[model samples]
Every structure is written in structure tokens, then in C-alpha cells.
Target: MPISNSSFAFLIISAFLFLSVFQTHGKVIINTNGIGQHSFADMKIDCGKECTRRCQLSSRQNLCRRACGTCCARCNCVPPGTSGNADVCPCYANMTTHGGRKKCP
Candidate 1:
């Protein structure tokens, strides 16, 4: 028995379609509960919500990190020891102060 040309073409087409579908679908495995038992196609969708919540909590005015003394000197925010006077805080290192503008120490 000899394979027909149409049958051969059909077989090739079927194989190509099968391969294209298989290659397009991908799986991502996520380990949850510290036991490696979770599988997810999109972990970021879940993790991102949690991350946003945590960031919001941390960015609260009272919860924000407060640096003072020399540490404040390096910060871009209000410089150290000048918390009472924003006018005296340094803007950037090597920058000059003019007309009450702050200069980096």
C-alpha cells in the first residue's frame, strides 16, 4: 500500500497544528504554604495585591522610616538637625545655599 499525496499533506498539517497548540500553552508552578503544593499560571496577580497592601501600610506618615543625625545628612528629604527648620536642610551635596536656601554639609 502506498501513501496518497493528499493523505500525506493532511498528516503534516495535523502534526503542525498539534505542535503549534502545544507550544503556545505554558504552565507556571508556584509553591505555596511552604510545602510546594501550589500551581498557578499567574502568581504575581495574587502577590501584587499583598505587596500593595504592605506598601500602603508602611508608607503611613507615622510608620515612615525616620533618619536623624548624620544618617539624615545622606537622605534626600529634610536634612538632619534641621527638622524644625526646613529652610536649613541641605538640598544636595556640593550645592550652594543662596537667600536662605539649604546647602549640603
Candidate 2:
């Protein structure tokens, strides 16, 4: 049986639409724990704001601190007297110094 031109066009359009929807339905598996996933260290180097926000929302507070510290150290914001202080000291110093202080700048 000869296929009609309209039927052929319909088949092609249906196939294209199906493929487009299939692509849109793909699963995006994100590792919410941030372990064995995309490196925060790398992302922070390039995109500091996004990295900081993600770290702030992290379930593991220590991990978040570490991530923030890594970004700060890369950006040369890590303070003095910080001995492996990636977990607390830097952030504490920043908060205490600048939380509500009026800057002369």
C-alpha cells in the first residue's frame, strides 16, 4: 500500500515531537551530599557567589565551612592565625569584624 503524503508528514512530525519530549524528560541525578560530585573547590574558583550560596545551604555545617574557606583562601581573604582554620576561624573573624561595623571606605 502506498503511504499518503499527509501520513508520511504526520509520522515525521510525531517522531520529532516524541524525541523532543523524550529529551526533555531526561533525569538529572544530582548528588545532594556534594560528595563524589562536581568539585565545589573548582566551581568556587570560577563562580564564587553560587559556591557560597550552596555551601551556606549545605546540610553538613563543617563541609560548608570548608568549602567557604577554600573559596576564601583562593581569593586571598583567609585571615591570619588561621591554622587549618577552614572550618571556623575565618568566617568568625569576618563576621565579627564586618557584621555591623561601619567601614571608613
Candidate 3:
């Protein structure tokens, strides 16, 4: 038995449609976590003050300040007025370095 040209084209079209739907739809389904509810406009953050206060307790002042600054800017949050309160900002607290260490000071 031999396949006709129309039958071969139908199989190719079906495969292409199946792959396109799954690839695009899968990402939308996986990324629907509610993390995006907090918009930038709703964030009330003082980056400079937050970073300075958070880094003040560290012995590595310069490095601590740099890391704290980066985290504050991105997260728009610093834990509190002092160090060791990372629980206040879950996103900043959960960020990891390339080595799997905590990235923020």
C-alpha cells in the first residue's frame, strides 16, 4: 500500500498544528501564578534609604551596599529599617546567586 500526496500533506499539517498549539499554550498555562498582581505603581519604596539601612550592619560595607542597592531597585523592597529582616520582602529574600547563595545582603 502506498500513501497518496494528499495523505502525506495532511499528516505533516496535523503534526505542525499539534506542535504549535502545545508549545505556545504550555507556557501560558505554566506562567499563570499570581506573582504579577503587584504592579510597579502600587509599590511605595525608598531605594536609597532602604538599601543604606539594610546594609549598615554588614562588615563588608561596600559589597553589602552594592548588593542591597541592586536588590532594592529590582524588588522595590528592602526588608525593614534594619538588617536580618529578609522575611519582610519574600522576593528579595528568595533571590539566589549563581552559586546558590543568597544574593542580597
Candidate 4:
């Protein structure tokens, strides 16, 4: 069967509306400072609060917050919970310190 141009156009518009509503589709967005921008186009995550939660139980809270915040800003993800489970965010997991230690808590 042959489809009309109007039908195709309607389908495209419908798909666009669906995506805009659900935000299943995203666009590249360069940030203000242009550093620590997320690769994904979704709204920015709260790295400060996330780092605070992640570093709450740390012996060195300041150090943990700094590192976790850096990783969260760059990777746009911090592993859930205060300790362990680094596997969830690969970029957060693979980051290393100058001393060859794990960077993110």
C-alpha cells in the first residue's frame, strides 16, 4: 500500500511530541564554562548534593566531597549510597588520583 505525505508528516510530528514530553531524545548542549559539561543533554544533576550524600560516611569528608563532586560533574553520575558500588558509573569508577588511588568515593 502507498502512504501519503500527510500521513508521514503526521507520524513525524507525533513522534516529536512524544519525545519532547518524555525527553527520551536529547540534544548536544555546550555549557557556560564549557568545562565539566555532561555528554548527555538532559538537565544538569546536582553534583554538590550528590557528593554530599556519597561522602557522608567518609573519614575525610572534605576530600571525598571534592573528588566525588568532580567525578559527578564530569561523568554526570555518582554511584548510589555512601560507600562502595562504584561499578554503577563507569567514568566515576575508572577515574584515578595522581597517587594511583581511586578518585571517587
Candidate 5:
């Protein structure tokens, strides 16, 4: 079967649109919630203190604080009382290390 130029262009455009939508699907799921409101409305963090405290047990203080800070900001929830309490925040707890271990400080 022979395809016309216009048909091929249409197919290309359709594929691009499909892929764009697929790539953004995850963001859409994360964004929508009750009343279309953000879940972190009252999110608060003492960045330096939280990071320092969370990373206290780690030998690599700088690395621990950096990664913990990122996870805290992204999850908008940090485990309470720190040190072996990551399970309190599912997202934080589920984060994986580069070597497939738990990464969140």
C-alpha cells in the first residue's frame, strides 16, 4: 500500500501528540485531588535544621542532607523524629538509591 505525503504527516503528528499526552499522564495524576486543591497547602520546613537533623547519623553529612532535602521538598512530608522513621512517609520511604537501596536519608 502506498501512503500519500499528507497521510504520513498526519500519522507523524498523531504519534507526537500521543507521546506528549502519555509523558504528561503521570504529572496529571499527581496534580489532581479533592477540589483540585494542592495537598501541601500548609507545608512547612526548616530546611537547614531538618536536613541537618535527618542526616545526623550519616557519615556523609553533605550528601545525606542534600538528598534528604530533595526528598523532603518533593514529598512535602518528612518522617517525624527522624532516624529510621522513613516509613512514616511512604513516598520518602519508597525512594530508591542508585544501587537500588533506600535513598532518602
Candidate 6:
């Protein structure tokens, strides 16, 4: 058996389509776990909800939530717990205030 011109073109086009989908979609699937240079940069999260949860343990809950929200908006990650889990999100962990204090809760 032999392949016809139309069939050959179909295979080539199918391969190209498969390759292009993976090439473009890889970025959308990868680097969304908050552990890369992109670091959840492509993810859409509710900062208000995450910040509220993050600030639950703070004595100054409102202030903590405000700062957490800022950090979450910038970094797109809110650590993992109410406090002291900044290692999980380096961007959130590393952000600093102008006054030389930690910015995120």
C-alpha cells in the first residue's frame, strides 16, 4: 500500500497541530505551582479570600489581610498556612516594605 498526497498532507498538518498545542499549552500548565520564575504568574486567584485566610491568626487581622492582599496581588501566592510558611512562595516571602519590615503575613 502507498499513501496518497492528501493523506500525506493530513499527517504533516496533524503533527504540526499537535506540536504547536503542546508548545503553547506547556506554559499554561507548567510554572503555576508557585515555585518557578513565573511562580503562579499565570494563575488567577482570589487575593481577598486567600489573604483573609492567611490573616486569621494575626492579632491585627485587618492589617495583616491588607498586607497579605498586597503581597498576593504581586506574587499570586499566599504561602500555605495562617502564618510562617513563606518558604512555599518565595515571591510572597521575599517582598519587603519600605520600612525594612516584612510585607506579607
Write model 5 residue lDDT over 1-105, tens digit each, in one string: 999999999999999999887665433323332323233344366767888877777899999889888887877766776577755676777778789998787
* lDDT measured at residue 50 in model 5 versus the true structure, 0 to 100: 81
Q: Candidate 2, residues 48-69: lDDT per residue as tens digits?
A: 4434544554577466556555
Identify the runs in model 4 with alpha carbons over 4 angstroms from their true place: 1-39
With candidate 3 superimposed using the best TM-score fit, by how many Å does residue 75's alpha carbon deviate from the native? 0.6
Candidate 5: regions farther than 4 A off: 1-40
Q: List the residue pairs that clash in candidate 1.
A: none
When 1 and 2 are scored with TM-score, the better candidate is 1
Best by lDDT: 4
lDDT of 4 by residue, 6-100 (tens): 99999999998988876664765544553533456766789999999888888999998988888888888888988888767767887898999
For model 2 the local lDDT of residue 73 reads 51
For all predicted structures, in order, the TM-scores are 0.27, 0.26, 0.58, 0.64, 0.54, 0.64
True-vs-predicted CA distance for residue 16, candidate 3, Å: 54
Cand. 1 TM to true fold: 0.27
lDDT of 3 by residue, 1-105 (tens): 999999999999999999887665443221124344233444357877777777787788788888888887877778776667776676788788999999987
Model 2 ranges with Cα > 4 A deviation: 27-105
Which ten contiguous residues of candidate 4 have the minimum total lDDT? 30-39
Q: What is the C-alpha lDDT of each candidate?
A: 0.39, 0.45, 0.73, 0.81, 0.72, 0.78
Q: What lDDT score is found at residue 78 in candidate 3?
A: 80
Question: Model 1, range 13-91, lDDT digits (tens) per residue?
Answer: 9999988865665454433334333333422223223223323434442222321222233332332232234343233
Residues forming the 10-long window of minimal summed lDDT in candidate 6: 25-34
**Regions of candidate 6 where Cα sits further than 4 Å from its true position:** 1-35, 38-42
Worst 10 residues of 1 by lDDT: 62-71
Candidate 6 lDDT tens digits, 38-91: 432345789999888888888999898988888888777787878887777788
**Clashes by residue pair, model 3:** none
